[model samples]
Target: MSITLKLAWKSLLNRKTTALLTILTVAISVILLMGVERIRTQAKSSFANTISGTDLIVGGRSGQVNLLLYSVFRIGNATNNIDWKSFEEFSNHRSVDWAIPISLGDSHRGFRVMGTNHSYFEHYQYGQKQHLSLAKGEEFDGLFETVIGSDVAKSLGYDIGTEIIIAHGISDVGFSRHENTPFKVVGILAPTGTPVDKTVHVSLEAIEAIHVGWESGANLGNEPSKEQLLQMDFQPKQITAMLIGLKSKIQTFALQRQINTYKQEPLSAILPGVALHELWGMMSVAETALLIVSVFVVVAGLMGMLSSLLTSLQERRREMAILRAMGARPRHVFTLLVSEATVLTSIGIICGIGGMYAMLAIAAPIITANYGINIALSGITSHEWMLLGFVQLAGVIIGFFPALRAYRQSLSDGMTIRI
Candidate 1:
């Protein structure tokens, strides 16, 4: 056995260049396959963590996914607003522990601005039920003050005390600017790897105060003075949505059912977990497609290994004859070939995982900045272990054809070529 391994190792070293190239090909493919799986799993986890500790998300009558997209992710505009009276009703319900109202439909420099009260910072949670905390300065206090998310502060170069103008509508450009009522950045939130990192938060009263004179989507003459608007009522008549937390986990469904059947207005109440699952369900098709592409890439890499082994067999014909003459059985030659492939594959797998960790460490910040997806630097998952096992198995299976060819050729060319 030792002699066979020594012979196999020397033969691979004899063709070191091709062997190294084949190993690298497999390494790159393994990196890609592992990366895709990692991203898929982490993306789902991040998505699920976006809204935790909240039992139900209440909003104006709409699809569950739609409400989750706009309310939690701030992706789109709400089709309608829930009446403020209704918000008060359910918020004060017996089963509800707390409610955080969310007012949408505003933007600043492409980042969505959210209107909520202090309960948002107190109740809203993410990434392991973690509460929102200010990285610098303090929460917004006055009507014209705002709190910026970590991504907003970093991307736009804004810090605490930087004044910003809010746009009337949600657009990157070509929207009416609310220049008359600029907000001071009073706080900057820590990075949460969730939607919170991309939002600009302010008081609900601030949302109402800014649009004081713009009742009909047009400024009614000049907008009100800061003092004048402050003197006027700042109570919001309607809100886009609310995040609800219950005192008891068992009452979550009953409260959600009550909110859904509220007669005061057309409303929808969706469990955050259920809604998140639905969103992932819609995205499963794309995830499957990515996995399939990665699998094919790995197959192509293994095929490259097979081709190299087959090509090297022709050059090793005399070597195989020498082995046969020395009493090395055909099965030994077969095992030798398989062992070489296994060694190459084992080395390739190690290099692939190493490369994956290095690339993730480098690209994590960029992905978080551009796509808001956080890829964790954690150990391999069970699914990934299975994938690696399958790849190793595939390498052995690919080696079979080459080993069989060598076995048959050695029998025919015993001591010398039959031709």
Candidate 2:
């Protein structure tokens, strides 16, 4: 090692406590900055790829965003339902390959209940065109049988054959319960790290069967017996939304136009990617706010690090005299000060990244459960590397003032020790 580097290392070791604290401060700031960026990137990935392998999302005429929200993410109620005839007609269209019907507006213990056919399990895709797989048991086969997502099973402690009651509405409390018409859990889907993880899937017939005794959202006459309910037809009159897969990519726009201009009922068909981009555009402001706050935190950390290095300069003035007496030029003293800062910052950056990985490893499950957002444990991106480069640049810039102070101290001391 060079003499200057050796001296710089010795000086940092002498103020071990202060140097360590400064490094830790920078490390924490890096953690927050990297965490925010990772979440933002992964959130966009998860939300955009929530449903793939489909050409378009078809729903009753409403805002494209709203239809995507209620149909794919199960976020809100549909303003209208497309009649079963309309769905069948579109499903049989020449340009369409497959269509999966979706029925919403019911809940089971705060988790949304989605009524769909076997086609959903067959055609729906997520996370890079990955199909849904059952973690346990098989798909629902009969009326009142249901398949649950991983989050639903984990949250409710449900297993195959476990019966759960459906709620009248999508609220956690105050919704009329579907006590008599309990559904048996037939399958549990593996976690996709998407909205699908929070849904309860049943047949469209099951949705109809449960609402048999209810009219206008309330039970009017006496409820039917189990025998009468079994004998009753279970055909759904309408559906909240439908996902259409086209036979040819070129037919997408043409099919979308056809759906939009359908004479039977007003309908909207949106490309999943386009709608996802629109949604992200609307949410970009909040994302920017988070990034700005994290940047400020990093700046504060750099300032704290600067303050600590500056405070240590007073005690090092005598050391500067000794170095000058040893034939070290003023630039040498300056280099020593700057090199020490560089070493501390390099270590801080390494520690910050390690700490971030540790934090993410521990917080992944909790985040998925609470927010339904997946934070992947992956390598740093080019953008993150650029962020680190900027941090190092800030360290070098912050070191400049301290290096200057040391340079002046060396010139003035001139072999005379200051008290």
Candidate 3:
């Protein structure tokens, strides 16, 4: 084995450039395949952890997907608002532990505006049931005071006491400005890796206060002036969605039934976990497609390695015959070729893993800022290690046939030059 290894090292050194290039090719392909798998797994985990401890999401009747998108992800606007009457009824239910009413539809420079009560800060949890923490200052204290999420604060460079105006609607453009009732950023919450990190939260009344003004841009002869609007009593009669945490999880189904059967307006209550599962079920197809593409890339890289090694064997025939004349067995010749391939592939796998970590380190901030996806660079998972083992085994197996062919040629040539 040692003699085979020694000859392998010498032979690979003779073709150092080709061997190294093949290694790099295989390494890069392995990196891409593994990186995609890691991102997919971690992304799903991150999504699942976005909302924790909330038993159900109660909102106006809409598609289940829409409810998940707007309520948990803050991705799109809610079609309709749940009446305050319905919110009250749900909150007062015997099975309810706490209800957090979330009113959306306003924005501050592209950041969604969320109107909720203090119960939001007190009851809402995320990422392994962790409570929201204040990064700076305190929670919103008055109607016009606002608490910013971590990403909002970071992106907008907001600090305590920064005054911000809420736009009248969701559109980044063509929205009435709330220049009259700008709110002060009184707090900044720590990162939660959830949609909450992208929201600007305030009391429900604040959302109503900002919209109290001229109608249809005609000033509505009855329109309230800026000062009058400021002094006007304001209360929100509706909210986008309500997150409910029941006193007992067992009562979840019963409460959902009650909400769905409400006599007045149509309403729906969905379990957060179940809804997330459905969302993932929809996403799995895309994930599988990506996985398939990555597998193809890996196979292509392996085939390239095989082709390169086979092409080099002819040129190395004379060198192999010389070694055979020096008392090397045909089996040793085979072992030497196989060992070189194995070593090259192993190096590629290691380099690929290193490359993945380096990329994650550099791209994490941008990814978090743009996609709100947090990817951690840590030791590879057991599954990934297993994958590496399989790749190495495949490299050896695939190289075996070429190695055997080279050995047979060297044996036939004996001590004479094949060329």
Candidate 4:
């Protein structure tokens, strides 16, 4: 190593405690910045790809956000039910190609139960318009048959032929149980990293048949025997929402307008893409706030480095005088100060990146299970590379202030030790 760079290295070693702390500060700041960026991107990806290949989500008259919350995310109670006749009219509309009616209101354990026909397994899509695939068995084909999700199977220890009782309402507890008509787990869907992974699926007939004796949120009248239920045909009286795929992209808006202005009932039809955009729009402010906080943390870390360097200058004045006596120019002293910063920053960046990936590797499964958002340990994107570059550049620029102080000290204190 050159004399100046060698001197810079040994100098940091001399004040190892301060230097180590500064490096740690920088590393922590980097971790927070990278974490925020990763979660933000993954959240958007999960929400956008939650449901796809559907042109519109039709529901009882409600705001787009409300419909999206209950229909797509399964986050809240059912807003309102669309009449079965209304669903039929729209499902058979000239512009519609297929429809998947969603009947939600029951929960098994802590997970939701969704009721739909086989069209759901056939037409429903998620993540790049990928169709839902069965991990085991086949779709529900009978009144007492049901399908489950990967997470449900893993959490509840359910597999093919495992019987599960559906609850009356969405709560995990205190709801009426449909014990008389237990649904057999006939199918299990592969994980999709969406809300579907947390749901149990049953046929629409199953939904109606289970409610045969249910009235006013409680069991009423005599429950029919399983054989009697199987002998009867079931038709859903209402559905919470329906996902529609249009015959052509050009007809999406035309049908949406028609659905919104239906004469029989007030309804809302939302383009999933538009609702997703609006959802993100409402959430952007918080994202920006988090980004701002991350930026400030980085600034505080850099400021801490600057503070450490400035304090070290007082003790190094005599050292600078000796360097001048050894024929070292003022520029050499400046170069030494700046090189120390470059070394500390480069090492901190490396440490920060390594630590971030380690945390992600550990937390990936927990995040996927709880949030249904898959965290991919992919290589750093170009944007992150640029962010790191900016951090390094700022570190280098921070060196100039300390270097300037050292440069002046070397020139004026030449051969004259100051105590």
TM per candidate: 0.96, 0.97, 0.95, 0.96
How far does residue 88 in candidate 4 sit from its true spot (Å)? 1.5
RMSD to the hidden true structure, all candidates: 1.7, 1.5, 1.9, 1.6
- In candidate 4, how many Å is residue 362 off? 1.4
lDDT agreement of model 3 with the native: 0.85
Models ranked on lDDT: 1, 4, 2, 3
TM match of model 2 to true structure: 0.97
Deviation in Å, model 3, residue 328 alpha carbon: 1.7
Model 3 clashing residue pairs (backbone) = none
lDDT of 4: 0.89
User: Model 1 segments beyond 4 Å from truth?
Assistant: 172-175, 411-419
Winning model by TM-score: 2
Better by TM-score, candidate 3 or 2: 2
Alpha-carbon local distance difference test for all models: 0.90, 0.89, 0.85, 0.89
Decoy 4 TM-score against native: 0.96
Task: State the lDDT at 368 in candidate 4.
Answer: 93
Give the 10-residue window scoring lowest on summed lDDT in candidate 4.
Answer: 410-419
RMSD of 4: 1.6
